[model samples]
Target: MKKLQVLYIAAFFAVCLVPFVGMAVTGQESSSENRTLAEFPQLKTEEGINVQWLNDAGEYFQDHFAFRNELVTANALINGKILGTSTASGVIQGTDGWLYYKDSLEDYLGENLLKDRSLYNISHILSLMQEYLAEKNVQFAFTVAPNKNSLYDENMPYYDSYKVSDNKNLINLQKYLKNENVSYVDLYEPLAKADEILYHKRDSHWNNKGAACASDFLLEGLGKEHESYTDETYTVKTDFTGDLDEMLYPLATTPEDEIYYDRQTTFAYVGEVGSNFDPRITTVNPVKTGSLVMYRDSFGNALLPFMADAYGNAYFSRGIPYQLTDVDTMVADTVVVERAERFLPEMAESAPVMPAPERTVSTGEDKADPEAVKDLEIITQGNYLKISGRIAEKYLDTESRIYVRTDGDKVYEAFPNDVTLDDGSTDCGGFTLYLPVGTATEKGNLEILTGNDESADIIFAKD
Candidate 1:
């Protein structure tokens, strides 16, 4: 009987080993696949372009990350973790030597991805804004925010450093904009040179200390005077870790840390709010009670309010382009599009390609070819106006209709609903939308959509 029992136990153990062996093989294959580099001819530098091991590392570290603060019911799970901490403060050691408050996704990708398309799209959009502003006789200026990693590259592990210099998209973009005579504030070199501590050692974002420095520089660039807001006036928010710390090394043990912010302050900004799926304006006054519209992303949150106090209004947003159509509707005077360097390329690709240039409309009745309808041009009484252009082409077999939507009002208005420009004389199709003089102007949003999948937003304003 003892011998039989031993055999049964042995068989069970052997069965368990089968699954483990299969898992090991599968995991190894996945890792090997990850190490393989993606082929892209345009990229000038591919040295650290592929880090296949990052996903596996992220998965392993995710289990030990702690969440805290029940700021809202939606964040209850995190709140529970915060409540579990001793004195509402918890600490975790990191793969990076320094102690930090918590982890943040914004920090993770900001550090990991060097060339982002979002920034490129922002540049294109800025170009469009420049053209639009120029036609309106308004001046335009732009700034791109640097990430914590860019600010503290040397402090990070040697293997994790990003070579910002050789990044093709960023390099090309900066050159292109400079050549075009676009006015911009270069924060990366300044922060790197100033040896300023823009980000928290533990958290993924800049402290009020760092934000103050940036705000001062921005004011100087804008030809505005700097104001006084010292460290003494700021408060240290204790026991908080950001997204990167959560992702990189959660299980490692470390000491507690704090993040600083300007506690008592107010700001004013004007920008659109809410998603196109759900549109609304959201406002906040972190220091003093008041309202400010903010056009922002993660980078904007830290710096906006401080600058908001300097302006009569501030506008912020989370980088969802569909919602951007409402930009003019927010009654914003100055629009600041903030993004980390990595996101530029994607934004450029995603922008609506210049619609096929408008074709000349021929009045067949006259033996002469009619002149082409030029780009849409509008004049507003309040000194605020938006001019949009697109390339439109239509094929004969497939009846195509280009639609324009403003705010949530579908096809709020359009020039020509169904028009074909297939014939060679008119190139088969085209339309130029223009808001006539004395048109009712209000804060509104606009987007061009065809079917479910094809859509792009054109954020505009009218006085």
Candidate 2:
């Protein structure tokens, strides 16, 4: 009789606890059935205390509360793929541990998820762009940001195997672009050699040092050059933990967040919309930052400042949409397109059909030696600039003249006789000409006239 009484009391307690368990899981007020706890459902008049119900129809409730929802199923599905496998990072263990592969799955992503040889067709796409832009006389340049894994793959426990001699995934794109006659900038080689910590020991994005190196490489490749420094004051914060460390190595590694190296004098955006330059939106205020858009990826955040000083303004933005809504109105004449190698194919495909660059417009006054003048070249370094080409000195002394302008400036300059004029095989005007590295214009129009004073107007940008 006593045992029967105990069982009856236990059954009573279990029945009483069911509602409490339901409340804990669904977080709904005992009376409410249409709202979810996360939605913070409350009686309209009450500010703090409110009913939390499980809404059967709302998206949020459907997502979190739905037992068979796709998202939950996806997580479980991914987990199940490696349910019994040991994690590459030994610390994480479980039949479900294989789901952790998401973090390091980029190596296999190309073949497994992304289309195969997508980059191969990128060259063809670029060629089409070149052909299309040629009609407009616009020159197209391609840049690709290298994957951090491409540089630090050695640290990874496993890598995807692809059949190609250039083990570095980024290098393959470079060869393809070259063969297609697409001018591309290489940041990987320089950044890899730089003596700075370019990335956090655990994070996927580059550290400030690495971004700066990449920016410098980009500037140099774009014909805008800058010097290197041992240390730059990037922002330093210790309270940062990266995604990888958050997941696999939770307590193992603590990472720091850093921005640019030194304090930069910010510049106001001259053409940006109302208060778009507000510092409240970004860590740094725009009015004081340098001039130049350091077009970059997550890795580009660190590198933009390195090149910002050279321009009147510098900005950093991602390339996904590749659309700067106001860029068409902000600045015109020159646009520097930068991207990592892995992203090049996509960048090239989506690249807008830019107008053809007007190399030699019909200036009306056309004079030339019966021979075509040797190729005139303008070399622009950050500090020094030079224009060199082979032209008939005799013609230059008389009918020939060198006309140079920058950014459409009317200021004309005389050709320096100091240039060595020697053409191995003179097809015309003069032989090859060598000019000092200091004579090129910074940002503006430049022209080199061979025989007649009339010149082919060319735009020159500083490196």
Candidate 3:
């Protein structure tokens, strides 16, 4: 009789907890993933309910499901531990609990490569950029930071199976850089020679030792030795997790050790950092030699101190969506472009990235701004309606705000891809936009929204 009573009470509690479980699962955000949870789709007056609404909502629930992180982690462990296979999360389980990112493998192996013309064009531009700086007594150099897989492929389980190809983008770029006499440094040999693991087993970036090695080469290239122990010190911390590992098993929090280093140099502040999009950094340091400007990616974060220590001042900026004018203005005695192997394709792109009307045109405004899109011409090619026009240059700094809608049908975003900047100042001279193909046809008209510059339905058919 007592056992029966206990079972009844257990059943009652189980039934009562369902609502609480539902509430917990409906969490607003996941700190582990480092991204916002998707919100419910908004109702649009112009375009009524669409098929994408249901798919988007389903995705939102899946991402925010109760114990999403725990379930992901458990699945990884099972697939990675017992099954001895690659996790669905794109992480490869290597020997001795080492995990490798498959994306890094793609990067290192030259998969999904860029074109040769683009690579050579990068070299040509660099040569021109070099001459532009050289006239001012500034030297230009390109630094190639080796990928983690390039240095530590042995740790991968199927490293022996992966083939090295000559048609690789990095290989071709390096060759072109050499042919063009582009001053550059490869950090592979020295970093690879080091006995210790210079890269984090769980992350894609280099560890302290690896960063230090790269710095050493930079100093060497600048015709100096890296013996600046005067004001530099380091502190170590353990139980650190890597970004890649966090993505695979957010709840697990894979642990590792990290070292933070500081450098003390003598100098005065010249100016503040640049805007968020274009991070122009200039600092005053003890070395009164000369100034330097480096177009670098994330790898530059670790190598900045070394550059700062060697030059009087240094300005670091992003390599992509770059402004040639900024490169000319940010004058330094030396200019170095530190590009990661994965980003080799960025070199082929044009300067200032002047996307038509520049990705920031007539967006979100209820009323059309007269100055938004100039010389607008809508034409059709294949299944696409192309938008060609001059966009006022002021909007180039942000994302393009243009929408396409078919009357009572569907809505899709337009991509303003091609551009030409006449003055290269604050005015966008030319741009080209492509409509989402399937929605536009020769028989139908499309409504265009350029931010606030809403337009009436216009026929894309040939006149």
* Per-model root-mean-square deviation over C-alphas: 15.9, 18.5, 13.4
lDDT head-to-head 1 vs 2, winner: 2
**Residues 1-463 of candidate 3: C-alpha lDDT, one tens digit per residue:** 9999999999999876644486476654364553566876665535776658778877776666566677778987787778766554556667666676665566556565655545555665565556556666767677778777777777677653466663556666777778778777777777888778888888767876577778777767766534644245777788667766787677776688887776554655457644322456666776566777777887776666666666777677765655434545655667778877666654454432211221222224344356655666767654456655654544433333344554525554343333324664222233334454554554565444543235322212122
Q: What TM-score would every model get versus the actual structure?
A: 0.48, 0.47, 0.64
lDDT of 1 by residue, 145-215 (tens): 66555456555433333343334444456765674466677777767776556576655566666667767
Q: What tens-digit string does per-residue lDDT give for candidate 2 at 1-463?
A: 9999999999999876765575467654321112333444334435653333334225343333422223333443344344532222312122312122233234324432222233444554455445544454434455665555555544333334342334444545556667668767776677677665566654556666666666666666666545555455556666555544444432343456655456554433334433322321112334332234334554444444455555554444554433333244334222345665444434423433222122232333344343333455656533334444454434443223344434543433332222222553222222212223433343444444432234442222222
Tell me the spans in candidate 2 whose CA falls farther than 4 Å from its real position.
Answer: 1-117, 127-140, 158-169, 225-227, 230-237, 246-253, 257-260, 268-295, 314-327, 340-463
Top-down lDDT ranking: 3, 2, 1
Which is better, 1 or 3, measured by TM-score? Answer: 3
Rate residue 383 of model 1 by lDDT.
Answer: 32
- Give residue 233's lDDT in candidate 2 (0 to 100): 53
Which segments of candidate 1 are over 4 A away from where they belong?
Answer: 1-122, 134-139, 160-169, 224-237, 249-256, 259-263, 267-294, 322-327, 352-463
How many pairs collide in each candidate, listed in order? Answer: 58, 59, 11
